[model samples]
Target: MTGVVSRAKGAPVELVEIVVPDPGPGEVVVDVAACGVCHTDLHYREGGINDEFPFLLGHEAAGTVAAVGEGVSTHAVGDRVVLNWRAVCGRCRACRRGEPQYCFATHNASRPMTLADGTPLSPALGIGAFAAKTLVAAGQATIIDTDALGGWWDPAVAGLLGCGVMAGLGAAVNTAPVRRGDTVAVIGCGGVGCAAIAGAVLAGARRVVAVDVDAGKLAWAQRLGASHTVDSSRLDEDGVVAAVQALTDGVGADVVIDAVGRPETWRQAFYARDLAGTVVLVGVPTPEMQLSVPLLDVFGRGGALKSSWYGDCLPERDFPALLELHTRGRLPLDAFVTERIALEEVEAAFATMARGDVLRSVVVLDGSGAGATS
Candidate 1:
C-alpha cells in the first residue's frame, strides 16, 4: 500500500510504499476510493494536534471493502462505505449512557501501519485514507447507500459526509437545531462554515448571515442560502458582533456558529447571539490558546454555549439520512466539491487548502486516473 506519511511536524507528507496487515478481529481493510484534503489533516501536518509523529494524514474518505476480519458479520468484501472517526466503544461510559458519540474509548485498528523501514505511523484520527488502502476498525466503515443518495450530495460527494461536512452540517441541524424562523449566523466561510449555512437553510432559518475574511467564500455562502454576508476581515472583533446583531434587529442572531476556531471569532460568536440564544463552537482551536470571558456573561447568557463533537452525529442514523436527503435534492452536497485530484498530488492539495483556493479538493480514487496507480 502507498500511504501519505507525515514524518514530523510542519513536514511534507511523503508518498511511501508500506505494508497493510490483514484485518485483525473486528477490523476491516478498505481499498480507499477517494479522500478529501481537510484543514484537520493540515493541522496534523503542522503538529497542531499532538506530538504523535509520523501521522497518517488523510481521513475524509469513501471506499470499498477489500477484506473483513473474523467476527465482522455486518460487512464483507465489496461493501461500499465512508470512513468515520467516531467509532464507538460500546463499553464506554458515554455509550453506557446512550451518548455513543461521546465515546471515551473509540477504537481503531489494533495493528499499526509502518513505514518502509518498519517505523510505526499514527493514522490521522484513526483513519489514513490518502493511499491505495488503509485499515480501520469495522465500525468506522459505515455503509452509505450510493444508489439512494445523489444530487448535491452525489455518491462522489460522500467523502464530505465522513468528517468536515458532517461536523459543519451537523452543528446546525443536530446540535444547534436551527428552527424555522430562527435567525442564524455562521462565522467562517470554509467548507464546514458553508455546510453550516446550507444546514441552516435546510433547517429553515428565516435569515442566514454568512461571515468570513474572504469575499469569495462569502459569495459562495450566499449561493448556499445565506440571506446576508459580512466581511469579518473588514470588521473588528466587536464590529463583527455588531454586524451580525444588526442583521437581526439588534437582538442578535438566534444561533451563532464560530467555524473559524480562533479566539477572536469565538468571542464574536459569544456576543453575536440574542440574549437567550445559542453559541455553537464548531471550530478546532489550538490548545495553547485559552478562552477567558467575563464570568458575568456566562451567567447572564441564558441559552446554551455548546461545543459539538462531530456535530453530535450518530453515523448510522445521520449519514444514511443525510445521504437520502441529498438524493432527494434537498441538500446541495455536490457544490461542496470544488476540485478533484490524485493521491500523489495530496501535498499540492494541502498547499491549495492553506490558500483556500477551493471549497474542497477531493482525491478521487475510484478509477478516476488515480485508481490506475492504486
Candidate 2:
C-alpha cells in the first residue's frame, strides 16, 4: 500500500510504497476511508515530537475493518470505526481505578508496518492512517454506529473525532468541565481551539471568548459558538487578558483554555481566569519552552492548573456520543472540514495548515466525496 513517509527530519514527506502485513494477534487492518491532516503530523516531520525518523504519518482517521486477528472479538470485519491512539488496556492501574481516560498503558500493533525495502516505519501516534490501509491493535478501533444515525455519515467528518477534534471538545467538556452559566475563554482558534469553543457552548457556558492573532480563525471560532472574539495580533499579553476580562464583565472567565501550548499563551490563560477558576492547557508545547511563575501567585490563584491529555477522553464512551450529537445537527463538527484532498496531496495540505488558510484539510480515501468543501 502507499503511505506518506517522513524519512528524515526537516525533509518533505514522500508518498511511497509501504508494506502492511496481515493483522497479528489482537490486531486489525483498517481500510482507511478518511484521515485528517493534523499539526502533530507536521511535528513528526519536523522532529518536534521525537527523532523517530522514517515516521509513517496521519492519525486522525475513520474507516472500515478489512481484517481482524486472533482473539479480536470486540470488533469484526466490516465494522465502521474511528481510529484512536489511546487504546486503553483494561488491566492498567488507571483503568482499574475507573479512569481509563488516564490509562498509562495504551495498546498499539505489536508489529510495525515497514517500507518496501524492509525498514521499519514508526506509525505516528501508533496510528499512521495515511495509507490506504493500516494495521492497529484491536483496542484502537472504536466502533461507530453510522446506520443508527439515520443517514449517510461522512467518514471525513467522523474520522476527525479520532484526535484533534476529540482533544479540543474533551478539553472543555471533560478536562475543565465547563458548567452552566460559566464564562470560558479559549486561546488559539485552530481546529482544536474551535472545538473547545463548541464544547464550551455545549456545556452551557453563558459566554465564550475566542482569542487569536488571525481574523480567519476568529471567524471560524465564532461560527463554532464563540460569543466574543479577541484579536491578539495588535495586543500585548496584558491587552489580551484585558480583552477576555472585558468580555466577561470585568471579572474573568470561569474557565480559560490555552490551545496554543506556548508559555506565553499559557501565562495569559493563567492570569485571565477569575480567582479560583480553572485553567486547562491542551496545546502541545516544545520541550525547550519553560515557564517561571511566581510561587506566591501559584498559591494565591487557588484554582486548578491542569494539562489535558487527549481531552481526558475514553474512546468507547466519548466518540459515539459526540458522533451522535453531530448527526443530530446539534454539533457543527462538519464545519471543521475546510477541504478534502486526496492522499497524495498531504504535503500540500501541510502547507495549507501552516498558512492557516484552513481549519482542517482532510484526505479522503474512499473516492466518495462525502464531505468535500473544496
Candidate 3:
C-alpha cells in the first residue's frame, strides 16, 4: 500500500509504496477512511519530534476494521472505529491505580510497517493513518457505534477526536474540569485552542475568552463558542492580561489554558487567571524553551498549574461520548474540517495548515487511489 513517508529530516514527505504486514497477535488492521494533517506530523517531518527518519506520518484517523489478528476479541472486521495512539496496557502502574489515561506503557503494533525495500518505518504517534490501511494494537481501535448515534457520523469529522481535537477538548473538559458559571480563558485559538473554547462551552463556563494573535483564528474561536476574543497581536503580555480581565469584569478568568505552548503564552496564562484560579498548559513546547517566572507569584497564586497530555483523555471513555455529543447536534465537530483532499494532496495540506488558512486539512481516501480508503 502507498503511504506518506518522511524519509529524512526537513525533507518533503513522499507518497511511496509500503509493506503492511499481517496483523500479529492482539493487533488489528484498519482501512482508513480519513486522516487529519496534524501539526505533529509536520513536526516529525522537520525532525522536531526526533531524529527518526522515514516516519509513517498521520495519526488523527477513523476507519473500519479490515481484519483482526489471532486472540483479538475486542474488535472485529467491519467495526467502525477511531484510531488512538495511546493504547493503554492494562498492567501498567497507572492503570492499576485506575488512571489508565496516564498508562506508563502504551501499546503499539508489535510488527512494523516498512518501506517496499524492507526498511522499518517509525509511525508518527504509533497509529499512522496517512495510508489506505494501517496496523495497530487492538486496544488502539475504539469502536464507534454510529447506529446508536442515529447513523449521523462523518469519518472526516469523527477522525479528529483521535488526536488534536480530543486534546483541546479534553484540556478544558478533563484537565481544567471547567465548572458551570466559571469564567474561562484560552490563549491560542488555533485548532487546539478553538477546541478548548468549544470544550469550555460544553462544560457550561459562564464566559469563554479566546486569545490569539491571528484574527482569522479568533473568528474561528467565536464560531466554536468563545464568548469574547482578545486580539493579542498588538498587545504585550500585560495588555493581553488586561483585556481578558476587562472582559471578566476586572476579575481574571477562573481557568486559563495556554494552548500556544510557548514560554510567553504560558506566562500570560499564569497571570491572566484569578489569583486562586487554575491554569492548564495543553500546548507542547520544545526542549530548549526555558521558563522564568517570579517565585513570589507562584507563592501568591494558589491554584493548580497543570499540563495536559492528550487532554488527559482515555479514548475508550471519551471518544464515544464526544461522538454522541456531535450526533446530537451539540458539539460542532464538523466545523473543524475546513476541507478534505485526496492522499496525494497531503503534502500541500501541510503548507495550508502552516499558513493558518484552515483549521484541519483532512486526507479523504474514497476507496480509489493507490491504496484504498476502505
lDDT for each residue of candidate 2 in 1-374, tens digit (9 for 90 to 100) = 89999999989999999999999999999999999999999999999988978999999999899999989889988888999998888898999999999999998999899999999999999999999999999989999877777655688998899999999999999999999999999999999999999999999999999999999999999999999999999999999999999999898999999999998999999999999999999999999999988999999989999999999999999998998888777899899999999988999999999999999999999875474332
TM-score, every prediction: 0.95, 0.98, 0.97
Q: Is candidate 2 or candidate 3 better by lDDT?
A: 2
**Model 2 ranges with Cα > 4 A deviation:** 369-374
Over 1-374, each residue of candidate 1 has an lDDT whose tens digit, in order, gives 78888988888889888778889999999988788889889888998888799887789888889999999998989877889997888898899999887889988899988887888888989998888889999999998655554312233477678999999999999999899999999999999999999999999999999999998999899989999999988789999998998999888999999998888989899999999899999998888888889999989988889998799898888888887777677998878888888778989998888888888998877564232111
User: Best candidate per lDDT, number?
Assistant: 2
Best by TM-score: 2
Candidate that beats the other on TM-score, 2 or 3, i.e. the better one:
2
lDDT of 3 by residue, 1-374 (tens): 89999999888899999999999999999999889999999999999999978999999998899999999989889999999999999897999999999999997999999999999999999988999999999999999887878776578888999999999999999999999999999999889999999999999999999999999999999999999999998999999999998998698999999999999999899988997999999999998999999999999988889999999999989999998898777899989999889989988999999999999998888632223122
